[model samples]
Target chain A: MEHSGKPNKIRLSTNPTNEALSKLKIGDIVYLDGVVYTGREGVYMRAIEDGEPIPMDLPAESAANFHCSPAAVQNEDGSFNMGAVTATASFRFSKWIGAWFKMSGAKLILGKGGMSPEDYKKHFVPNGAIYLTTVGYGTGALLGRGVKQVRALHWRKELGLAQAIWVIEVENFGPFIVESDLEGNSLFERENAKIAENLSKAYEGTRPAVLKRFGETDDRKDELI
Target chain B: MISIDLIQQTAETLMDKAAIEIPDDYLDGLKKTASQEDGDLSSFVLQAMLENYQAAKEDRRAMCGDTGCPRWYVKMGNEAQIEGGAIALEAALRRATANATNGVPLRPNRVHPLWRTDHDNNVGIGAPEIEYGFEPGGDWVDLITVHKGGLFGTDYRMLFPSDGIEGIKRFYLDCLVAFGKRGLACQPAIIGIGLGGSKDTCMVLGKRAACLRVVGDKNPDPKIAALEDEFKELGNSIGMGAMGFVGKSMVIDCNIEVGYCHTGGMQMSVHAFCLSSRRAVARVFGDGRVEYRTDPDWFTDYQRRDTVEWNIPENQTKSA
Candidate 1:
């Protein structure tokens, strides 16, 4: 178990070399090297609704064309970086799709906004998936690092930017903090618990009248003017 | 009789001039703000402000590429007469659009909602928005140019009055949680708030209000000003650590714009202009005198940070 650049001992559903992921418990820092797909709001929605297959053949430059396959992160070490393949904002999509992502063989999800605690623990962890995020709106800079690859999948023509799927090879990808793992523990859940605790304390400090004021509805038509 | 062609030509010239003409006042203001914002958030804001100046000066590019659909808000005198005022205004805008597309290479942002067709020249149905106001004794038309920067994404957070005090706190907390979760989302971004309006108007005002701030300038309304302060404090308290864990500054400025609303409920909208609230404005009078508005320190700061000498290009410095 080399500690230098390997992923901290975690379970992975898929093996680095085989299509079928094998169970591994060794505490090895696995630097991810393989084909990863990129998708965002538009891409996720279209695929879920239309049952479209992810395009794995399109070039990286045309990722924006399908809305789902435009972005990729190349590691500084010449390996497929998991920098930008995090999950799309999961809350925006239906719950059923979480399982769909697992079925699609998407080993890593990269996005800024986190997902529901239950969903990550239940769906992502058991399925051997990981989440990562990049600097938001740093797409311009991030994209600058992307090497254009051939598109592996395409879909409806009417979908334009929303229509294709691309399989990208990334390298030396990340220093991403793990929010959820195969064990089902999550950072988001911990944070939410703290928020809930704080809210409760604040509520206890407030008087009933003040709490009532919070409930008072202002229906005045003049307020808007 | 001046034909629409002349108006079109003049409008095009003004737009082109507006694109490059960096106002002395704006440059100075930017520099001042950058110098003062020694804090974690202000630094990034200052850097963003300076970057805008550099990009504009180096490439002679429009400060913000969006350069929002050309808009002309004109006040006409009651007694003023023209051969073809409306048509001239239209043609002038058309010409301006053409010039901007080629000269600035601005993004063709205009698209039909339903058809999704690109208005190749940044022109669309009733676009390059122009609004008219009439004054009884006014003698000349006064023109103002406004360019909007950035787009709406995870960088911004919108809050409503109904969101409650707890909700407000939660909103800020949520942003931090999101930032922590996603790494750094957007930094040196301008935080714009539209306090009260219809849903659509709230969003629009949020964007407009963000655009109104003069770099480091604070809001005038005491209540709203206080809210801005709270937001700033809460944002820093999270220790997102400037630029999402990096030592760079976090937010540049928080601008609040409030409007009267018919709906009893408050609708708050927020827009984040990523470290590049690249915006520029110009006022052109009928007498051919032009005044550009931007913070003056902007120029000095650019010189200081980029170590580039600040010289108002001779061609651009001349009075319009």
Candidate 2:
């Protein structure tokens, strides 16, 4: 097997400092320490849309906000069983992210597919936050191994298990790549630009469909998200 | 009669297996794809996935947090009979699905489309859909469960016969490039193409092609098989790989399933079975024998037969 050079790897605290956050670059591998929490559309709708007070301390308890719902359950005996944990697509959460950043004081956003560059430029840059995307998008077991303990779970009744807030203490909880750095640079967009140069070559012998969708782009460079 | 208890038990086991273990054929295909991958980031992603599979098996946890939508495909022999008939068999499968959702701790991915009501057990009205098929003979029942990630990497388009092969290639590329950016479709996937069926059946055939068939398996028709090979190569040549990085591992395999359609409409749908590619299968017999396997073995000659009447093969009839 051809072994390409590995990307630079670092271990950072979930509650990171300005100096610590500044050192990150796009495509660098990252492993997180300390505490992180799961929050997505459910949390967004309630905490932001419905104007519900956040149940925990902002960024103090956990600065890393993960767009995830673990394979987990709340036992009748008042305990939690969390197995594999992985991220969902972050793009869908873009609408409420700016408000989320201000309200939560979140410094790190972790998820599956990274958000658009416009999001990074607007919300992430102003808030001194960066984005780390989970590797393979299915490395749930590996990420699960990083959990030291389930600290707490919130909103079980109101939001249900999948949308409930899961506060977790983690050790080396990652295999996340730096998708966005402090300067608002996006690794995915960078890679997409490079890949676009060769797309025409790939689409060499193909022809467009007879019937077209209402709002479809023929440009290979255009991205759905 | 096939015992309902066995059906439920086997189904629960299949759900656990589908969530935790990587099927062998897919693993091998990925290993080969990994070896050939040149993009550093994409290579790392593939390697991490390989390790993740091992971690899941060793720890008995799900490979992905979004454990997809769990669904069933049950194939029975002509002589096979369930203890409480088809309805009872369906209830057992639903029970198995709910029990395993908590037991395996699978994410409750199913929900009411508008109300978004979650049962928190991966089961509700029409949830964990159970599809069926039947063979000509024997008293054995095959149970297959697939947990495929529901979002992204799938699309449908209606094309005329005049649009031809080039049109198919174009739409395929469109789905790939659109979802491929930022790794939405989760490339390095098993790409299933369904052509010629009406809209709904086109989606079904494509999904079956991707989820039911094993890696390296091809269509029985040589011409279709050839197209599968060509499409696989064509997909990998798109200058993308795992996570949409610059590489050549976008497709682990490409499978095409076709059905008769209106003479003018060449309906097409594309489905992607992601890196996790979760599926598991087992067979239960009237003799109380049970066996587990990875391949679904779904598209038999009889299943794909075009004629109205099925003539039992001479060799098989003589042996019987």
Which pairs of residues have clashing backbones in candidate 2?
Answer: none
Worst 10 residues of 1 chain B by lDDT: B296-305
- Give the C-alpha lDDT of model 1: 0.45
Best by TM-score: 2
Provide C-alpha RMSD values for all models, in order: 11.7, 1.4
Which tens-of-lDDT digit does each residue in A1-225 have in candidate 1? 011232343322212322322332212223233345545544666666676655443222221111122322223454332211222333444355474554455555554444566766777666665544322323322222232343343442443322234454444432233445455555444433433333333233222211232434222111110
Candidate 1: residue B267 Cα off by (Å): 7.8
**Any runs in candidate 2 off by more than 4 Å, and if so which?**
A1-4
DockQ of each model vs. true complex: 0.08, 0.68
The parts of candidate 1 lying over 4 Å away from their true place are A1-90, A94-96, A99-103, A147-156, A162-225, B1-189, B193-206, B219-231, B234-251, B257-278, B282-320
- Position B12, candidate 2: lDDT: 97
